[model samples]
Target: MQFDFSARQLITRLIFWLSVSSFVGYLIGHVWAAMTLVSVSLLIWHYLHLNKLVTWLWNSKSLSPPMAEGGWGRIYDGLYHLIRKHRNKQKALNERIRRFRDGAEALPDAALVLSNDLTILWGNKKAQNLIGIQWPGDVGQRIDNLIRFPEFAKYLEAGNFESPCNVPSPLDAEKQLELRMMAYGSDQVLFLARDISKVHRLEEMRRDFVANVSHELKTPLTVVRGYVEMIQLAENDFSPQWLKAFSTIEGQVSRMDRLVEQLLVLSKVEVNSDVENSDIVNMPEMLGQLIEDSQWLNVDKKHEITFDIAPDIAMLGSDTELKSACSNLLSNAIGYTPENGKIHVSWQYDGERAKFSVTDNGPGIKAVDVARLTERFYRVDKSRSRDTGGSGLGLAIVKHVVSHHHGELVIKSDWGKGSEFSIYFPNEVISSLKN
Candidate 1:
């Protein structure tokens, strides 16, 4: 059995051996020689144990402690226990890592770990199946080099991950993939790619259905409206109640016509994913014409309309789409604001960006409603919206237009106070400027 060899016990044992050796030497008249022999023997014993310990540390595969007595045995036992604990902990840690890797591999979406510099550090099999990222070979390559789409490259370079980038698959043109990036560990990014071909196809089908239905309804609506107008021309022959009924019918027909027209416009914008940026748009001229039209529409409301348009502000965009977007905003302000309310419109280009804003002192929208303002058919007050003849497609059209031009639509409003609708165009779209 090995006893714990404390320093005190070892010292006591040495003292006893020395005393016994000295006693023998004194009897034989060789005390110094006996003591030297004892010391040398003790030194040799310690040297042998020290060599055994060094060998165990360097090359021993077994956890069993080397046999010894007293202090050396105790030291061996201590080392064996320490190494065993460390090995067990390491084994548990490795098991956890294996489980995590297995879970990641089983995910349906393609997942990749990337360094800050966008180097592909690791990816699962789905990455290969979805985006053609081969394992082992592509691990050290930069992700941008593998996915060469201009939109995808620009999105990665911009470092903005708030919105996912939707692009056609590089491997197959018919397939669609939505790519998202998120911050992972320090200075690392987690990239995810999902197959969204079905979702994309469904969206396209919906747009096509809306466009076709709107086209079909147009002829019938025109015929009905023409007949209603013809009947109104003979109001003198009808009774008072009949005349009033005919008037209501005409108003409803007009509202329906407006709704169908707006739907066609929205579908057209949605179908065209990219805009033609070749045509230069004169912001000052376009907004000036819209303000005039707005004043004419506001004759009944008598809202104090004002505009501050900067001259010669130009950008590359579709003139027709820009006019539709600007017209909607101005007309919305005139329609929604209370009578005698103040409306202000401004167009400004400060070299970096150009902005068009319409501010109105009307019944401002609530905080919750502001977020859903751009949703088609969403209205803060449904009954009031009907009275104002709002088809609820105006803001939706404006949003799509701004997105198509790679711009932002910002709406700021406070309940019971006022609201401002602003569209900002990035400097890249600005084609010319004059002070």
Candidate 2:
């Protein structure tokens, strides 16, 4: 329903106008009359041509013509405004998407977005680092192909959205991690990975420590009970030699008692509770008391004791606990050292930290055994430890106390030279007590 005018028709109209003007001049005998006829005809032709040009431009498919002047034109202009608005909105949406991608790339934990078919859609920086994935190459790859864990593959196939499944690191892996998968959207899954090896190791250590403690306590109690029963049953028929044996049995019983007491103290310190009810213990005074106690305990052996305490050194801890810890260290030293050998107790402030050290001229620990010396019931010479009435829990208790106070315990010894046990308390504790 459209029409177009040709250039030939426009040329014919010009020729007709010139001819009409010549005819009018011959009839009317006036040049003005001929010019007026020529002007009117040309005006009519130009108006008709203008209409045709406008229709052709509007009907053309290749170019968008300007709107007409009326109600239809207003509607066309409204549509144009709506199209521009949509374009602006789309541009804003794209910008937000770019920003979101940048943020996801910067995250530290390994994060992956998976499609419904268990294919990886996208992965972050940490994912690439942890999983050894190449960016463009990894997208659209099946997750099961990359992870290669049977349990995780089964977990994804199970379609359980309520609970997450853990995927452990692969064998011979560099970084150890635990991956958890959860359904995030209608057709998507989110995979999160975290490093939990340290936590796992800590849990294992706790279990081992508990088992060792139980075993240690059970052995001593069994021995002590057996000796008590023997002494009670043969009391009436006991001679002087039997009486001496009874005294030895009593010594073993006393050693067991000390072991039980130390175990209780260690248990209390390790419990999940605040240890705030402590006193400002004077180190010099406590050392003096320990020396006196050691002298009495070593009366028969006659071991030499030495003290080199720094003046005015103090510590913040339970008076009974600290005294017990120090006493155990000194007692072990006195019990192990040969007669007339030296046992030295010294105190000094290294910078702001306080160091309490006990050095003994005893048979030193072997290089290999030093690592496990602080473990409960771990004795280098089991027979010697039993004979000297050592509970084998002394160093273990010292280690627990030092850890509880956020401190460090260091043991230095050569194969031939004596061992030095140093307990370092944090400087903050000392400064707080001073203030």
Candidate 3:
């Protein structure tokens, strides 16, 4: 339709030029002069068409493409159709982007789109509320400048997103926020912030509740144990049956007392969120003490126990926690091994981390129960565990202790062969003693 105007104008101009040329020829009485004027006018029309094409090419952002007639018209029309297709595609893409942003805005957690340079590009409404971002007002501002959290900046630069970092929520001091980053789309990063304040508070409540109950039961347990021991000491005052009953009572009470003490220690370990004054642990000395305790524990079974300990192995953590973890593993080995069976304990450093392992030639645990071995009250052989006076919280206590020290507990076993329980303290928590 646009080219039709060019066509009509061309035809009108050609006719007008021919009539003028004819008039000039008539006035001059020369046919050659009129023919030359007509040719020049035709050449002028071609120049105007070429100029329009050049202008269209130069101003590529123009709303509409230029139009022409004759040979140039086909070229212009082809380019115009191509531009229309491109514009349609662009419109569809823009719509999809808009929909994606709307979906992101609806998310509950704060979400931010950041440039490779850590500049704030875009963010959702929740992000605005949480991070106090004013959208377009802070568009080009550096994200670190706004958040000012040292750990977050460190994590961003570290580029190790395997774990998230926790920090206080920007909106409320009481709230805790977990922040993680996902890298995408040409060096850009997607940051997500979740409020974990509720979870934090619940964990705190659980710790406090466990601690309070353990503390309350301790005094009564001590009195009961004292009376039970006194009764055992008194002889020839009752029938043999009554003495046997008293013995059972004494054993049961002692078991309960031990459980209570462990519960108290476990609660204390759980409640401590950070380490304090923990760098003075003597690993070799600690292992030696554990060997002595294992020997005493195996006196009834008379099992053969061995220790291969590495010297200069020290770690930074609560001494009580370390002792509990190592002692529990050794106790499990000594309890399960048959009389005269061999048990081996090793303390070694493998460059990256220090490992404390207890391996025994006892009845191997089933594969089904291996995963839950660390769970409180879980037992592969419940009857055997009870017969051996296991309170069923040893492994659970060990797990908490290891985790408190930022270490790992790994269990390996082959059916009918043996079980090996190992604690690996990461290098971050391990250092050599000065001596």
Listed per candidate, the RMSD to the true structure in angstroms reads 2.9, 17.3, 5.6
Q: Which ten residues in a row have the lowest lDDT in candidate 1?
A: 1-10
Task: State the lDDT at 427 in candidate 2.
Answer: 75
* Model 1, span 1-435: residue lDDT tens: 335557799789899989988999999999999988998999999999999999999888777879998778788988888899899999999999899779989998999999998999998899999999977779889999888898898898787899999988879989999999999989989999999999999999998998899899999988988988898899888999988988898899899889999999999888776898888888888888888767778889999988888887898999988999999998898999999999999998755889999999998999989999999888889999999999889999999999989999999998889999999999888876565
lDDT of 3: 0.83
lDDT-wise, the better of 2 and 3 is 3
Q: What C-alpha lDDT do the candidate models reach, one value each?
A: 0.90, 0.73, 0.83
Task: Name the regions of candidate 2 deviating beyond 4 angstroms.
Answer: 1-237, 272-274, 431-435
- lDDT by residue (317-396, candidate 3, tens digit) is 88888888899899889998888888999999867999999999988988898999887677888889888878778898
Models 1 onward score TM values of 0.90, 0.49, 0.80
Which candidate would rank higher by TM-score, 1 or 2?
1
Across 124-146, the per-residue lDDT of candidate 2 in tens digits comes to 77776777655567998988888
- lDDT accuracy of residue 388 in candidate 2: 86
Top lDDT prediction, candidate number: 1
